[model samples]
Target: MNDRENLCLLHSKDLLDQKRLFLLFKRLAGQHSVSIAKNIHETIKEFNSATFTEDQKLFEDLYKIAATIENKVIDVDVLKQGVNKLLDNRKTIPQPKPEDLCVNDSVFQNKILSKENNQKTAPVPAVYDMLSLLYLTTNEKQRQQHFHDLTKYYYRQLKDHLKQLSIELDEILPLPVYEKKIKDFIPNAKLEVILHYLNQDAKEDTFTSELIQELYLYVLYPKINIEDCFKIAKEVVGIDYNFLSYELVEANGLLGALGQYYKLKLTINKAGDDVVLNLFAKFMIDFPKDAFPGGEDAFPKVGDAFPKDEPPTLSLQEEFVYTIFVPELKNIGLGNICDFLPRCYFMRSSDVMVFEDLTYSDYEAVNSEEPYSYEMLLLVVKKLAKMHACSLLYEEITSKGSGETTKINVQFSKYVMGFSQAVDTKFKDTIHYCNVNTTVNYVYNQFPDVAKEITMEEFRERSRDIFDSMLDKMKTSGKYRNVICHGDIWGGNILFKFEGTRPVDCSLVDYQMIRYCPPAQDLMAFLYINTDKNTRTNYLSKLINDYYTEMSTIFKRYSFDLSTVYPYEVFMDSCEYMKSYAVCQAAAYYPSSLDRKKVQDLLGSIEKTVRFFAVDKTEVLKVLMKHDWIRSRFREIVEDLYDLCLQK
Candidate 1:
């Protein structure tokens, strides 16, 4: 076919497809609307003579029917008729005697009567009156006019409310008024129609449908008069609805799970534009009490499980990084790295940390297995050097009492050196699982005969011993000199900004594990967790040299001798000593670092750490075996640790 003919044929096919889709949607919408109308009618008929005892069952049935109608488009006329019939039946039912009324009914009656006395004597038509006028009228033109007028009324009500709140309405543009009239109105009209239609009826079905439709419209169309709904809601409930806007985006629950995660996007209007905020909220409301195989509690309190005076809480550590460490880094002319850290706006009710999103700023997080180029690695190493140098300078400045400084007391060693009972438990469980699992066997089988000579048991024992020594070293401010180490320096924690394929800048995050430890802890963690076997083998020396050189330059700028503070020899020794710990961390975290899917799955799991190891073990083991450089590195570390154990 000719190019013009092919283009014409494609356009015709697209048009036909769109028409088919529109017809299908229209048919489905009509069927759903009729179904919902019938269900509403049946429910109301069944509940017409229902006693107070059957009220709960009536609402439950209505709730199920309402849930089915969600996301389905309905005919306005059918919905109006169903609602009016229900309302008429509700009015015909005999009212309960004063003595027969429940406590809730009596309280509601008194509250309404008191409200009526305080307000104006003139009776206003309820929302049902407006909906009936819009729907039942025979003139299509009049119905359309009524819909437009009703929308304008709601917007005016929102404006009045805003004015009452002492907000300047002139500065804040009202929906439908500020934007293109026809374009904005079309999308928002459906929600305004639904809300006005469903408002006066107090039935569970009506209220739920209204709420669901409002939430749907609020998210899909930003120009909806959501503030008016909030105002009306507050007046009806007699309590302050202080929040601006909240809409749930994702929700998942597992049976018998201790926790649940809810992802929500909130809209807060400040200045002129709306600021959309994304939040992931976790609730640890339930506990199994005897979840473990031996009838031990899975979730234990710090005081019950550990003897530490101060437990390392994620909130406390994050707050410290936000309020203290970030400012210090910026002060030392290392603002580039600080830009990567998630800006904590505030801690809401202790558990929720509202962070300024970097995704919107074009900073993308690299996935697991996405190879970091030399330039990208260089950028990260330079930032790490600046951060470490700043830490040294901060300590020196604080000691001299030249200005206000945060008291450094929460050492990384105190938290990681068997101090956190949770970490200690996870460590034991992970090692035990690795020792017994076939995944490890598969990995060992792939290694050379010489490497395989070290039995799994011996490997396990050597790993444990190395971890102990490393912990002891981490706990003390030893001869190697301590600086602020990004306790969790993995691929997942690092975010990079790129100009096409080239990395321009980088940032470090997840500061809950921040600790005062040897800088090698951060360096090794990054190398082992981020780099492939080949990259590590080829560039490890150069990277280390560059890191020391950058650190030296930064120290000199701050008027401190790099040798007196942290010498090149000491840094190398620390890296060598911490090699075993790096390998162990790599084994534990490598699976999660490989992909976003793994990270999300791990986050959602009940036994997060255990489940992460179980799911990722085989994948990580395969990576370790397949890559010659990685396999060699692992074998070398194991042998070095084994020799040291033998010497001891």
Candidate 2:
């Protein structure tokens, strides 16, 4: 027979097996329920048909049957006895015809046989294989043995296909009602609930209690009360409790976002007992046009706005790392540094990602004020070097026989305009709230020695020009070797595991802003935002050396010569190029990183500084002088900039 005919015959055989199994289960359950009812009625005379109405007796029997199923009180001895009695009475029992066994007539037709052979092909023997044995064996003992084997085979098949029965039940009743009904039969009711939801053929318009129960079982806990299921559904899934109808559920502001996230959680399972999974569902759906100010126009598009080869969205970038980059890193025996990555359970496009919660391991994010210590800084530098080396290796592997120049798949240039625009907007708003000229004059007066080369006009002109061109300069500068940068490397993006006063390990998170740029972009941004002035000045050189050592070690492992690929001198020059970008970023972001009340206080002082310093007055200088932290930070930035300029 041809392959197609063979496949058709095999499928037909499976269908026949399923149909026979279904019939066997129906007969077994019916006989078992009747036998249990007879015994119950015999014990309780009041429940007997003679004492009670037929309908009432039937109802009581059904209730007892359900209770027995729920309590798992089925007796195997009684079941065997009942099956034996049924077999003995088979002469009086109606036999299912061949037509009844084959649900679809066309499926059993000659079309499934090889026409070239024109010979009847014997079907593959299966669970029903012993039927002919029973008839052929004239000896009572052999016939009985065949019957027992057939019964055992059919029962085993019935148990194996229970999930298929559940699917059939789902079609007969609504999923919620089907789930409730199956709970009595299944020990793991939560598994049934999860399976039912996942197997759903119809899309739901509103969140149902059944759906909430499934989510609670998977995302939160295995055993949860129904009331708490509703509560968690409301609190965690962002559903409304007051309105449980489809209208209200569909109208929920967070429904679309929650739906996508819920789908993601459903797709992933727990990795191990030690790891706690936490999904950061921070995405928004259908945001208002005014929310992003410029709407879709402000964001870059695929192919048109960014290179066609690069990943167009943050989700795609993260997906690439999890699927391609991380695995490649592990392949090269650098999985130790990869511990910083939360174990990715699964990722769907960019809309949904499930990760193991690192908090379970006592890892916490450091805030802006709490900078990384010298030891922690060394670990971070090593981690960054590993990350960069993996990217380099990935580029080499993907480019190997393509005969094309190796390039990182991420596009950093797309974000430059958007970031510059945001900085400019923030600057304008600050000037509108206070006075730019006044703020500059105040800084110049407060640090006359630092501002000796620049007048108020010069300071105003240079600051605006610097903000506008900073990203471009960082991108174009050949001082550093281009590498994949963890685009958002501030304190908030990193998590550390501390062993009492010292950070022994660290992990990076929030890969949404990953990009292709010089390694210094990440290095400088991380240092400036996560370290104090003294830490930056004193340990900067050592940290760079630490990063290079790690990078060189990784290269050597992969048989690449570091001298030609990325030398120490090239790295140092990259740091110089990154210095200007880092100082500007730190100054711009410093105010936002402060406590809310502190930010308000600083803004108030800024307003007063602007009013006084507008006409070259020194009153604002006193306010600036009071905030020693701010003054020190600015002083360090100016010193770094001055040194950079002198080098030029």
Candidate 3:
């Protein structure tokens, strides 16, 4: 406790600290070079065994080790921080009790525990106390609001940093500066690839085709190699063959609802006779940069909807639908499931999916611009009901085996339509800001009587509320006896197998948006998107009754009582609840869906249509209204939405 004893103790502690500092530097130097690390280790060992008289020489040796580390270390910032902390401590002697002189493991742990206890017992700041109380007292909504605000604040900061970086790079900053900054911001960021994507001057068609070709090569070639094909021919077909060439089949301007299609023809010599196998290739399309005149700036609200860095989730979702969902249906005794599902041949995770071409079997997709006739609609609705029944039966069978009954199968709990966060935000933003606004504005323009009850803003607000309410209901578990609802049930997604002029059978394509939701969601969505106002008015009740009857029949076949699971009354009520959802979706998609022109065609060739439902929506609306196809279809959608809002 005396000054001389304390001084001696401090001196001893300083030597221990010096040894610890050298050990730290030696560990860091290992990352730079093994030889340098060895030298520092030896110096520390020698210093540790040195007498008090040799302290000056050891101190000089330690300085040299520090210099070596400073020069060679890759992480200079961390090394500098350690060194600076040691330097700062040198000015004041650390007081340690006589028991602390040993610096053993027990003593170190005790010190830490003692420090923590002291900190805990210390007087607390009032602000921190208030914060703790607030956190404990706040409800879910309040906590969500706070978290949302914090997220938005952080996002703004991040966006500001990105904007500044963009500006600095535009001014031709030195490469080294950006290299350091970018790595600090985004670990393992590929500057070259990002820059290439931003600066490429390739024409739109060439760029898209090249991307598709690259994806096709990456996905299909790996699965369809020569050896694999030879094995397939010998084992499955009983004919050994030479794998020949493959070529892309031209569709002549056919565009998919959510993707681009390419029919691939593969030729192989079977018994010296040329045999051709057709493969249907579907590639998940991103929002091409050239499709927007001002690039992301054109869609300010959803600029990052399809960022180059993040791949689209459509292919992966559809892959799940094929590999997990439909296969499970067959496993659970739904023998006719494959009749409705295209035989998927090869599917990559995010971009490319290959299937046995359904067209080869006389299955043809309905025109995207045309509504399905009542007979065709009836067939499609019954098929949808069967799919729902199979999903229910599968859940029932699996739950019974597991001894736990869940409302929805655990595998199908997550919503698949907007499985990715980016896509979900984009969809919600498009629906709320673009779809809701456009539909309301159209109503205001075309139907003054429909718009008479409220202002345009009021109508937008009410429509948004209605759509949000539908989303809430959809998200609610055990809502209306959920089924595996085909999230995008429409004409474009259905393929009819015809016998001469009449349709004999049908198969649903594009299972990208399957969700565990009420069957009414699929039913209403089908009617709203693929049927005109007149068609729905004339045959809506009939179609619903047919869907119910088919579903009841399938359930009865599987020994399920429809009344015990999903009653007819409950299905009708769910349909009424989802009516607004269907209307909102129809309004959003009709502008693009009703037109024969592809998204790129309208945005690229038509200057005024560049901001279609993305930006300057009113101007684009004016241009769209000029077209009879969009105007007529969009009017029906808006009229339905307006009526739904009035009822609300």
Candidate 4:
């Protein structure tokens, strides 16, 4: 077309572009990157509606090219550069896109920086191409990696910006920065930087898409329903994220001995209530209908598959899993408190993987640089204090039975469901190939008599008694205060967030065993799982002191008297209880955490089990035995069965 006609077209398109820009801002506020890009393309077509001046047409052509950014918005900073090219002398405004930046990115680092900061970088077309493609992809984990590569997947992303907003970013952030940056369009990008940090703080293998989705929605749309995300999995998601699988021993099959797996991507309005997305495990497909051939019997019939006589893998693997997302609920708005869980707790839940499920050790060995230490064990004590506080305030926060529902139907016994009782119940050959010479086996082997007396059946019976006792304590404790206890606060569940603000700031997990009970339950349970020599001597007392100190911190918010509960004597009582449970919990779990070879031998070491418990039991009983009248108390606890059963 002629210059005059083109000029007319350019002017008309500019007007249309102005209107569209406002809408783009609106979509950005909603964090709608895809929709925003589509609208921008529509606005660029306005250039074709009218004629333009020679100079105007040239500018309009640039606008048409910029409109092609159909995945993410033109880093307004980039657009500002084109604006300068159009109006040659206007250099004062911050240029969203600079001509010198790499507009084209083959690896996508530039596009990520653009999306991350909502601005331009070295203008290179290769960068744009890679990002544009990633935008179109359907994977979340892959998308996150693409974004992460730009920042080297560390807190280094805008680290300088983080320090600048030191006070705000230093604390745990409520959401990811990329989502926040696109919203509100604020001048200070502090929130955006903080968002990146929150993402970095999460361990990669531990990163579940459900947590990411849940956090994003909860922080942004307070009213979104969780049902919308029930079906979301690795194949679905809008945000570009990548699964981080740590090196692990893989069992063959479509399911590679599922330990911690993941999926990731972005979203449009993919959120449910509280804007948080569930991540632990996805919904398991329908049984039989989706199972391998052989009608309903094709799949390994659920039972105690762990060769107790041989303990191939802990019988835990056979547990039927209904869902697969490792839950990491985020954006927990506890008003002023930054703790994510106060707002939401992580439940490694699956409809199919309920308590009545198959047996299997779902976890593998964690490479702890050092074994559990006094300092680390102390951190766990503090964790118990915090969880107990939350439980105590359960009634104040919500009416629902937070911990009771889960605990009521916990492992009542180790009965092999669906199988007949005629099977030779006890595993005969106790020594496993892996645990023969390990310290775990050696420690237990020292005392063969007591360990030999306790069989799997006996253990199950004892567990039932323990459960019954717990129910009674829960009832009595309810009159005082009950908090959500990590019913199984073993070393495996209490994670150490060593880098975050609260050095010992622990994030709990595996909530299947969550129970509504006294905080003492959590304190005892965690100590039972992690307590050892140096822990008992050098750190135990001081740790209890620290827990009280931390308790005071949480209590100050609710005006609680520290002395009324958790006194030195109460703590001592609690410690004795925790010690008693050590033999039971350790026997079942040591195999999963210790170096595999050593861990296995220890599990089948009945000789060691008897000996270890003998010493442990004596020490534990010594504390309670101080009161010569304790035998009667024990009899009452064991015999008053109905009173001990969980009421809820």
By lDDT, the best candidate is 3
Using Cα atoms with residue i matched to residue i, what is each candidate's TM-score against the true structure? 0.54, 0.51, 0.58, 0.36
Per-residue alpha-carbon lDDT of candidate 2 for residues 1-648, written as tens digits (9 for 90 to 100): 332332232221132233443354344333322322233213221210111112334333322332344323444344334333333443242332221111111111122222323433332111111121112111222222233334444434433343344322122222222222222212122222222222231123111223332222322321212222222233333332221211011111111111222211212112222221233333322223232324445343434554432334435455566777677668755576566567665343424455554666788766544456899888888888888887666566555646776665342345422222232344223322233333344553555576456554555566555554555744423445566567667665578899998788888876655666778788887778666778987998888888888888878887777777777788788886677777666654443342223433443433333332122323434554466775776566555544444443
Roughly what TM-score does model 1 have, to 2 decimal places?
Answer: 0.54
How does each model score on lDDT?
0.47, 0.45, 0.52, 0.33
On lDDT, who's better, 1 or 2? 1
Candidate 3 per-residue lDDT, tens place, 108-209, comes to: 112222233342221111112212222222222232224223222322332344344342211222222222222221211111111122223212322222
Query: In candidate 3, residue 135 scores what lDDT?
Result: 23
Encode model 1's per-residue lDDT on 1-648: one tens digit a residue: 332222111111132232332332233223222322233223221211211122334334433444466545544444444444434444464442211111211111122222433422211111222222222221222221233444345335434544555543334332322222322223223322233223323244343354444434444423223333232223233232233455544444211122244444555444556655564333333323233333343332345332232333434455566766677667756565354455654332223344544555677677555558778888888888877776776676565565654334433333433322244344334333553343234443444343354665665565566555555544435566677677677776677998888899887765655667688877877777677666877898899899899888877776778887676788899888777667656654544455545345445544543443332356435534565555555454444445554544
Candidate 2 weakest ten by summed lDDT: 245-254
- Measured by TM-score, how close is model 3 to the native structure? 0.58
Q: Which is the winner by lDDT between candidate 2 and candidate 3?
A: 3
List per-candidate RMSD values in Å.
17.7, 19.7, 21.2, 21.2
Residue 519, candidate 3: how far off, in angstroms? 0.9
Report the number of clashing residue pairs per model: 1, 1, 0, 98
Question: What shift in Å separates residue 339 of candidate 4 from its native position after superposition?
Answer: 2.1
Higher-ranked by lDDT: 1 or 4: 1
Q: What would you estimate as the lDDT of candidate 2?
A: 0.45
